[model samples]
Target chain A: MRKDRVLNMLDNAEDNIVERLSVPALTDNEKERLLKMSMSKLEGMSMNINAEEEVRGVDVYRRPRWHRFVSVAAAIALVSGAVGTGFLLKRSGKKPEDSFHAVVSPEQTTELTTADTVSTDVTTELATENTVIPGTSETTADYQAIAVDLMKAMNAAELASSGMLNTDANSPLASDSNYFKIVDGNIKGFDFSTMENVRNFLTDNFSGKFYEQHSYFIEGSDPFFKEGPDGLYARYTGRGSIYGWDKYEPEIISSSEDSFVARAEYEIAGTTFQVDMTIVKSEDKWRVDSATSTLSDPDANNTNNSNPYVSLCKSKIEDKWNELTNESDNVSLDFVFNDLDGDGSPEFFLMYGNGEYNYQIDAYTYKDGALKAIGNLPGSHTSFAVDTSSRKLVLIHAHMGAGDYSWYTMENDALKVIKNEEFEYQEWGSNEATSRQDINYLSKGCIYKIGDGTVSYTQPECPINEIPRSNEINSFTLDIVDQLYASAAE
Target chain B: MTGNEYRRLYAESPEKAYAALFKVYCDYVYAIVYNKLNRVAQREDIDECVSDIFADIFFSYKRNGEDYADLKAYIGTIAKRHAINSYRSLKLRSERFSGDSDEEFASFADDTDIETNSDDRETRSILISKINELGEPDSTIILQKYYYDRSSGEIAEMMSMKASAVRMRAARALEKLKKSLAAAGIML
Candidate 1:
């Protein structure tokens, strides 16, 4: 073994032994004895007048009730003022993008000036007045500025962490709100006091969206939020906590007078996803109307939309097909470019759609000299989009009252099913509701990716394991119905 | 209480200051002794070692002016050195007396001495002294990373640095430690 390894092992062994061996807590008598002995020793070192009276060990951290009240009130005032200002700014023709920029500016200001002033003041104070040392910064104004800036920064940070700041370039239309209301709950009304509250709120609200999205894509329910036989909770019971601070790199995709689309990408562990948030002027404050997440393509240059490389890909596919088939009637091919393998070169995707609904998907890559067909996903009558963040090809298939979406990727010259989920809403509850319930229906069956090219099929159970299974499929059914409604509306 | 608070009270009301300091750091001091002398010393021995550590702290404070930027670190140094010294003496005494009986010597010979001997103690002490010589954050980093086994993320949190930066610092500190150890003829 290496010397350092041996040493660490020995040290760890010693630590383990020490940990295992019970060390009794110091008894009251022992503590008093030790305190008295230590005090006497301290006194003997330098005889202070009235040493006996001074070392009484009284509680030193006592404060009047008014002081606590004032502190709490001040905290509340600061938070309320900042939030109110944020809302006001949004109302007064200032975008959240502006607020983000403003939050960043103060941090830079504090960083530049805080150090010099604080250090100089500390040096001067330490050299002169030895007793009255401020615990934080040098001056009250500096402290206040820092605290206020911190509050604003923290507000942004908290929002970003809660996935509220996670938005993409896509917006859900007003007509499709009910289908997505469970997925993207109105962030306007939620509280952001503590990290836990933020996490719980997201977990509670987004749990349905997560289960539905996964089930639709045939991905398993998140282990953290899953309660039991029922897949997700009816209401957000507000239980458990999620770890990590949310950090995002945001880009303003587009903006107008009443609404703006913003894309914010965030990374957790190593996986990255982009959230597209659509903010609309609701009453006075700009509220998040809808949000959706997709895989963030780090390599894809979205800025330069007219990519020459993509153009080259289109030319190659069209030229090759024209040479072979020489038929273009009633055939329309749409192109979407992305880098699936992280090789810096863009993967070319062509959707060969007939004038009707049937579309055949083919993926191509440029290697050697000519264009090469990497793989093809035999298409059905479906709508499709690429989740650039996760590098997965998403296919949405809706027929009659059933909707199924599958996430596919090319691996080893073959199509790999990452996740496939389908849901069927079997009721005309919108018309034949005795309880005036529109779109209320029964959702049945779910399937998710269990492994590479493997999927597990099961019915989603109620997330809350406490109560006996009652109205178990109600939430999932609503989500499925919502999905169908969204598909139809789109 | 903060380091400044301790320093102020140490200069002014020495007894109350010591009381406050002891109240906060007694467990910390005891933990060092307990770890260093575990399985080798009795409970009484650990208690005595802790008391000795406190005496050393008191004397050091009295000798030096009130400019302790990190009181925990200062106390850690004293406690570690004193406890290690106590453990070394106990180990050496056991080794010396083992030769008194042939059977006892045979049993002792079979059992490998994992605890530090006299030579190991000198090297360990020298290594610690060199770490202290490294000063401030480097010394603290080495102790926290290697001795306390704190993660880079945790160390980063404490130091208000990025985890990558903490890892870089730990690497640099380990390199410096190796060089210093080689110079002291420890070479580990």
Candidate 2:
């Protein structure tokens, strides 16, 4: 932001504060009323309303909402681990249903782990896992300095007011920019792919502004400093709707204050997202970066079940010609589904986008499938993902206009992620999980609903055979993958 | 910090949680209710909802203990949603008594005279100001979506957008008002 404009916005904002807000002291009657309104539901909820009956009985039972409202002196009582569980969830009056429950089930999940780094928080607790920043070895005074530098890189209003944000009318690259990238470095493990094949598969299957995107404008210190005083970039770009496929850009802020992090309010898609960026210095320069932003594929915890269909598939593929569109000057999307020949199957894939978030994808499946991506406005075809689960073909893409992931499964004839659950990639580093010593996260992951379009999440308890194993990240997600792999090996 | 220590504290006194919750969320709650429920003449109700959410949060902590994950995220998510739910749900329920219940609720957008042919952004800001006046979830969801540009699906998961009917109702209420109010040449 121009220094003058920024200062002006701030001044205007300050002046408007009073007219916009009026603080009133709570009266006796008002306090009583507030107390009742507050506890009516909480009194019943203090329990894991969604937890299993047996689990709820295990001491984390429902408590009266009024009980917790004591003064701060009383608040110290809640410091206990066991007692704290009650506040996690409120119970429901309805009788037991299926018994499974989850809170804040985001549509996207990311995983990042070095091919050499081994397991993760969800997997084993690496004996030498460095979760904290290695450089913070000094005392509190050192951290204070680091925090101060972070504040220097702050520039949120500028990003929020950028032409792209104001409207496509001003976005220079609105209709033409298409490039797929995964930026990762300073912070380890924060990496993902910009798969054109996956997005193309989605475009073919959807109609009416085929994809979606959830964006954010964060002002934080750069984790990897290149020179001078590091500044936080107006991180922009879009992510696809496939729960975890979302992209964000880095818009550099001008400052030398070191690393001070402040999240601008970014509410796109149906959910609001706040990116937490950590700052660091390298090569005598200050820069704002995310711990989980990576372009390279880390060691993949993958399992592909393939077979003899290769011979026939290869022959059929050799028999057909592939079509490619260079229509997008900077972006080109091409894909040949291994399920070639319209068969209901998925195989090999390839493609590309114009830039940080301009993309196109086309998937031809012998598996009896086809895809179509319709772009309506700016940020055009950022990036996307595709997978066929539960007989229904699921597609994920990002919208240029809205900064949120759009989920679509072929319905009738049009592809639509008309539900909020369909959006993904709420925030940068949302999936970026790092150890205290490591500069970057070991991996990233997102959780989403698969059945009945309802949220049902599973943490990869046993991320892989190499993980050292800990109960921390595991406690957050279900390890269905680990279970499956274990059973399959058996 | 130990589990037993925390439990003993809560057992010794329950008000501890309420006080704690209040401090942690005072700014946020005040911002939401004051902004969204502004038209709600019952200042008592607005105040009640704020304190209630905190009290409820404290009790919830005492009831359902969580040792891991960011505590602020956990509580904020629940509190914000509850506050909004109460405002909207309460308003809807009160309307069931349509006959003589002193229906003084006026259109928040009644004051706006935005141009009908205004561009997307012009229409967008008008919607934002009106929603902001209504406060909380209405403003939260609208600004988060239209202003920030989030999808409805993402919103649904973060919040209990609940039945499509409920969401449709909120959307209809918002969209209709934005559309109609934009035509208010004088206000625009």
**Each candidate's fnat:** 0.05, 0.12
- Candidate 1 is graded, for docking, as incorrect
lDDT of 1 by residue, A175-248 (tens): 32101012222222344333344455443333333323222111222211222131121111111111111322
Candidate 2 lands at a TM-score of 0.25
Model 2 / residue A81 / CA error / Å: 43
Per-residue CA lDDT of model 2 for A341-392, tens digit only, reads: 2224333332222222122222322222322221111112222222222212
Which 10 consecutive residues of model 2 chain A have the lowest summed lDDT? A64-73
C-alpha lDDT score of every prediction, in listed order: 0.40, 0.29
Best by DockQ: 2
DockQ of each: 0.03, 0.06
